[model samples]
Target: MQKTNAQLRAQARGALAGQWGTNVLIIFLSVLLGGIISGIFGGMTNFETGSTQASILEFLVDNLLLFAFTYATYFVALYVVRGGRAEAGQIFVIFNKKYYVPMMIINFLNSIAGYIVGIIVFLPLAAVIGGGVYLSLVISNGQNFGAIADNAFSGVAIALLILLLMLVFLVAVSIVTGVFQFAAWTKMDFPNVKVGNSLRYGWSLLKGRVGRYIMLQLSFIGWYLLGILAFGVGVLWAIAYANVSVAAFYDEARKEIGDPV
Candidate 1:
C-alpha cells in the first residue's frame, strides 16, 4: 500500500525525534562540517570604505564561493555517511576524502537550478531593493529630504511590501530546496540513484510529500528552541541530532522498502 502523507511525516519525524543518540551524532557533525566550510568562506573578509565606493568589491570576493561550499560540502559529507554505521572519526574521514570533485559537480548543478528559478522569481525584488537603497541615498544626500519626503512614505511602504514578500519567498524556497537537495544526497549515494536521477526523483518525492517535508524541516526549529534555552551551548547538541536525523531519513525510509533500485 502507498504511504499516506501523515504516515510519511510520522515516519520521518520518528527518525528525527525518536533516534536520540544517532540523530544527535549526524546533526553535530554536519553542523561542524558546515562551520568548517563557513569559516573558510569567512576568512575572505571584506572592508568597505564609507561613502566613496559605490559598493564594496570585497563583498563579492568574500562570498563568491560561499554558495557552493556552504550547501554542497555538508551535503556530500552527510550522503557519504548516511547510515549510523559510521563512527564520528569515520565521517570526518569521509568528509575529507569525498568533498572536492563530487561536491563541485553536485553543487554546480544545484546552483544552476537555484539561479534559474531564483532569478525569475526574485529579480523584481532585487531590483526594488537596489532601487530603494539608491533612493534612500539620493533622498538623504543627493537631493533635498523635503522633496522626496513628501512622497517618502509611499516609497517606504512599497519597499517594506517588497521586502516582506521577498522574505517569505526566500523562506519557502529554502525549505523546498532543502528537501530536494537533501533527498538528492540520498539518491546519489544509494544503490540505484545516479546523480542525474537524483534531482528529478527528489523533486517528485518532495512534491507529493510537502507536508512531511515541512514537518521534518521544522524539527530544526526545536533545535533552535533548545539553543535558545541553553544560552547557545545546546546548539552544538542540536546540530548533531539534526544531522543524525537527516541521515536517518534515508536509512529509515529505505528500511520500509529496501533500496529504491
Candidate 2:
C-alpha cells in the first residue's frame, strides 16, 4: 500500500531530525551560492555601464546558475530521504555536465509551458479589461467625473470579481503543475534516461495522485506561517522540511509503481 500523507511527513521529519544542520545548510548554500554567482556577474558587468550583450550574458548565466542550484536542492533532498549523509558541498557536486544539461532542458520546457499558459489565460482577460475600460470611458463621455463616479460602485465590484477569478486560475494552474514535482529526481535516478523520458516517468508516478501530492504541499502552509511569524528565519527550516517531505513522497511513489525501464 502507498503511504499516507501523514506517514510521508513523519518520515521526512524523522530524516530531518538531528540532521537539521546539514539539511538547512544545503538549502542555505543553494541560495547563497546562486546569489554569490549573480553578485559576481553583476559586479563584473555593472549593469549601468554594461553593453546590451553583457547584460544579456549576465541574465543567461544567472538563470543557468539558479537552475543548477535548484537541481542540487532536489539532489540533496533525495539523498537525505534515502539515508545518505548530505553535505553542503553536494550543491557544487551536482553542477556537472551530466546534470546541468538535463536541468537546463527541463527548465526551458517548463518556462515555455508557463509562457504558453500565461498567454492563453491572460489574452482574453486583457481583451475583456481593455474593452470594459474603453466602454466605460465612452459611456461616461460628456461628464467623465460624474458618470465614472456614479458607476464607481459597479466598476469596483466588477474589478473585484475579475481579481477573484484570476486568483482561482492561478491556484488551479499551480495544482496542475504539481504533476512535474519529481522531474529532477527522475533525472537524478536515471542519468541514462533522456530528459523528455525522465519528465514522462515523473508524470507517470503522479498520474492519479496529484491531489494527494498537492495536499502534502498544502500541509506545510501552517509551518510556513509559523516561519513567517519568526521573523522569516524559521522559513529555512520549513523549506528544508518541505523539500525532504516531497522527496519522501517521490520515493514512496516510485516504490509503489517501480521506475521506467
Candidate 3:
C-alpha cells in the first residue's frame, strides 16, 4: 500500500475538496473575529496634539492583551476545533480541559528557545554587515571620513532595514514550522503522543513529502494573500481555505500511509 507522492497528493486533494467546510469556517472566524477585536480598540487612537504616549497608552491597553490573547485563543480554537466533526463549543472545551496548558507550555518554551537562538545567530551578522553597508555607503557618497562613520541617521536606517529583513525571513520560517506542527497535531490527534514525539513525527513526515506538502499548504496561501489584498473581504470565504488546506494535507498523508494513514 505504499503511495507515491503523486498518489498522496491526489488523495489529499480529493479529501480536501470534500471537507472544504471545516478549514474554511475556521479561517473565516479567525480573520473576521481578529478584525473585530482590532476595530474595537482602534478608535481609541491618539489624537494628542504632540504626545505619542497618548496613543501609546491606548495601544498598550488593548493591543498588548489582544496580542497575546487573540493568537492563543485562535490556536486553541484551531487545535481543539479538530475541523472535522467537533462542534465549536466542543473545541472550546478541548481547549479549556487539556490542550490550553500543555500547548501553552510547549509553545512558550519553544518560542523563547527559538527567539534566543535566532537572536544569537542573527544579531552579530546584522551588526557587522549593516555597519559595513552604512560605512561603505557614506564613503561612496564622498563624505569626509569622520562624517561618514558618524552618520547616525544612515547607520540607524541601515540597521532598521537589516532588522526588518531578518523579521521577514524569520516570519516565513516560522510559518512553515507552524504548518509542520499543525500537520503533526492533525495526524496524531490528542493521543498519548508527547510534543517531542509529535514534532519528530512531523519532521519525518515532511522529509519524504516536502514537494507535495508544500503544494498542499500553498492551496491556502491564496486566502492569506487575498485577505490582505481585498482589505479583508477575502476573509469571508477563507474558512474553505483552511478546511481544504488541512484536509488536503492530511488526506494526502493518509493516502501515502494508506487506509489509516
Candidate 4:
C-alpha cells in the first residue's frame, strides 16, 4: 500500500530522531562550504581585472563547484535514505568517482531542459515588454496616442496570450520535474543504473502519483514560512526536516515499486 503524507513524515521523523545532531552538522557544513565557495569567487571577480578568459574560467569553476556540492548533498540524502549512519563524511561520497560523471551528466541535462522551458515560457513576455518599451518611446517622441490606441489594445491581447502560455509552460515543467524527481536517488541506490535508465525508472515509480508528491512538498510550506519568520535560523531545521521527509518518501517509493531494496 502507498504511504500517506503523515506516515511518510512520521517515518522521516523517526529516522532523524537520534541523528538530528549529525544531520544539523551536515547542514551547517554544507552551508559553510557554499559560503566559502561564493566568497572565493566573489573575491576573484572583485579583485582581479575582468577579461574574457578570466570570466570564462570563473564561470567554469563556479559550475563545477555547484555540481560537486549538489551531488554531495544528494549523496548525503541517499545515505540517510539507505539507513546508513549520517555523518559529515557522507556528503563526500560523491568523490567516489564512479558516481561523479553520471551525476554531473544528469544535472547538466536537467539544466538544459530547464533552460529550454524557461525560454519557451518567457520569450513571448520578452517580446511584449520590448514592444511596450518601443511604444512608450514613440509616445514620448509625440506620436499620436489616438493613433496608437488600437496598437496598445493589440499589445494587451498579446500580453494575455503570453500569460496563458506561461501558465501552461509552468504546469508542464512541474509535471516533468515531478516525474523525474527521484532519478538521482535511483542512480545512487542502484549503482548499476545508468542516467537514462534511472530517469525512466523514477518516472515509472512516480506514475500516477505526481499529484501526491507535489502535495507532500506543499505540506511543508507553512513550516518554510515560519522559518523565514524566524529570521532564517529556523530554515536550517526546516531544510533538514524536509530533506529527511523526501528521503523517507524515496524509501517508500522504492519499496512500493518492488525495486529490491
Candidate 5:
C-alpha cells in the first residue's frame, strides 16, 4: 500500500530524530559551495547585455553543482532512511564519472523542457502585450490623445486578464509536468540506469500519483512559512526535514510499485 503523506512525514521526522547535525551540514555545504560558484561567475555574466559565453558557462557549472548537491542530499536521505549513518562526504558521490554524465544529460533535457513550457504558458500574454503596444502606436499616430487614453485603459485591463490566465496555466503546467520531477531520484535509486530509462521509470512510479506527490510537497508550506518567520535560520532545518521526507516518499513509492526501494 502507498503510504499517506502524514505517514511519510512522520517517518521522515523519525529518521531524522538523531541525524539533524549531519543533514544540516550537508545542506550547509551545498549552499556554501553554490554561493562560492555564483560569486566567482557573477561578474562575468550579464544577461541583459548578452554575455553569451560567460552566461552559458555559468549556467552549466551552476546546474552541474545543483545536480551534484541534489543527488548527494538524496544519497544521505536514503542512508538515513535505511538505518545507516549518513556522512558528509556523500556529497561527492555524484561527482563520479559514472554519475556526472547522466546528471548533465538530465540537466540539459530539463532546461529544454522548461524553455518549451515557458514559451507555451506565456505565449498568450506576450501576444496580448505586443498587440496592445502596436495598437497604442497606431492610435498615437492619429494625434488623438483621448482615443489613446481610452485604448490604454482597455489594453491595460486586457493585459492584466491575460496575465492572470497565464499564471493559472503556469500552475497547471507545473502539476502536469511534475511527473518527471523524480527522474533524478530514479537515477539515485538505480545508479546504473540510463538517463532515458530512469526518466521512464520515474514516470511509471508516479504516473497516477502525481497529485499525491504534490500534496506531500504542499504539506511543507506551513513549515516553510514558519522558517521564514525565524529570520531564515529555521529554513535550514526545514530544508533538511523536507529533503528526507521526500526520500522517504520515494522509498515507499518504489516498494508500493513492487520495485526494490
Candidate 6:
C-alpha cells in the first residue's frame, strides 16, 4: 500500500531526529553558495541599458548558477534518503565531474520546457484581453466601431486566435512534463541511468499519483507561512523539513511502484 503524506512526513522526522546539526549546516552552505553566485552575476539585471549579448550572457549565467545549487540540494536530499551521513560538503556534490554536465542539461531542459509552456498558455489570453479593452475604450469614446473593427479589431482577433492555439499547445506540454516531474530524483538515485530512461521511469512511477504529490507539497504551506511569520529565520528549518520529506516520499514512491531503490 502507498504511504500517506502523514506517514511520509513522520518518516522524515524520524530520519532527521538526530541530524539537525548536519541538515542545518547543509542549508547554510547551500544558501551561502547561492548568495555568492547571485551577488557576482546579479548586476546583470541592468541589462536593459546594456547590449543584447550582455543580456543573453546574464540569462545563461543566472540559470546555470541556479541549477548548480538546486541540483546540489537534490543530491543532499538523496543522500539523506539513502541513509548516508549528511554533511555540509554534500551541497557541493554537483561539482563532481561525472554528473555535473548531465544534471545541468536535465535542469536546463526542464526550465526551458516550463517557460515555453507558460508562454503558450498565457500570451494569447493576454493579447486578447488587451485588444478587447482597447476596443471597449474606443467604443466608450463614441468612435466608429465599424471602422475600428476593420482597422484594428482584425489584428486583435488574429492575435487571439494565435493565443488560443498556443494555449492548447501549453496544455499538451504540461500533461507530458507533469508525468516526468520526478525524473531529477530518479537520475540522482540511479546514477547509471540515462536521462531519457530515467524520465520514462519517473513517468511510470508517478503515473497515477500526481494529486498525492501536489497535496504533499501543499501540506507544507502552513509551515512555510509560519516561517515567514518568524522573520524568515524559521524558513531554514522549513526548508530542511520540506526537502527531507520530499526525499522520504520519493523513497516510498519507488517501493510502492516496485522499483528497487
Q: Give the per-residue lDDT digits (tens) of candidate 4, residues 126-225.
A: 7775677577658767476555555554766777887798777866676566445578788877888778998888787777777777777778888889
Runs with alpha carbons beyond 4 Å of true place in candidate 5:
42-50, 136-181
Instruction: Encode model 6's per-residue lDDT on 145-236: one tens digit a residue.
Output: 65554565467667777767775775556455544446777777678888888778877776687677767777888988998899987787
Judge candidate 1 against the unseen true structure and give its global Cα lDDT, from 0 to 1.
0.53
Task: List runs of model 6 lying over 4 Å from the truth.
Answer: 42-54, 137-181
Backbone clash total for model 3 is 9
| Best candidate, lDDT | 2
Q: Which residue pairs show backbone clashes in model 4?
A: none
lDDT of 3 at 228: 70
The candidate, 4 or 6, that scores higher on TM-score is 4
Q: In terms of TM-score, which candidate is strongest?
A: 2
**Which 10-residue window in model 5 sums to the lowest lDDT?**
172-181
- The global Cα lDDT (0 to 1) of model 5 is 0.74
TM-score of each: 0.58, 0.85, 0.54, 0.78, 0.82, 0.77
Question: RMSD for each model, in Å, please?
Answer: 6.5, 3.3, 7.1, 4.5, 3.5, 6.0
- The residue-by-residue lDDT of candidate 5 on 1-261, one tens digit each, is 668999999998898888898888898888887777777776565654347876677677767676677667767877787777778898787888877777667766776777787788778766866676567868578576566556654766777877787766656555534444467777766787777887877777777877787787778889989988999877888888887887787777777776523
- Best of the two (5, 6) by TM-score: 5
10 residues in a row with least lDDT, candidate 3: 85-94
Task: List the candidates ranked by TM-score, beginning with the highest.
Answer: 2, 5, 4, 6, 1, 3
Per-candidate Cα lDDT values, in order, are 0.53, 0.78, 0.51, 0.72, 0.74, 0.72
lDDT of 2: 0.78
- Where is model 4 more than 4 Å wrong at Cα? 45-59, 127-181
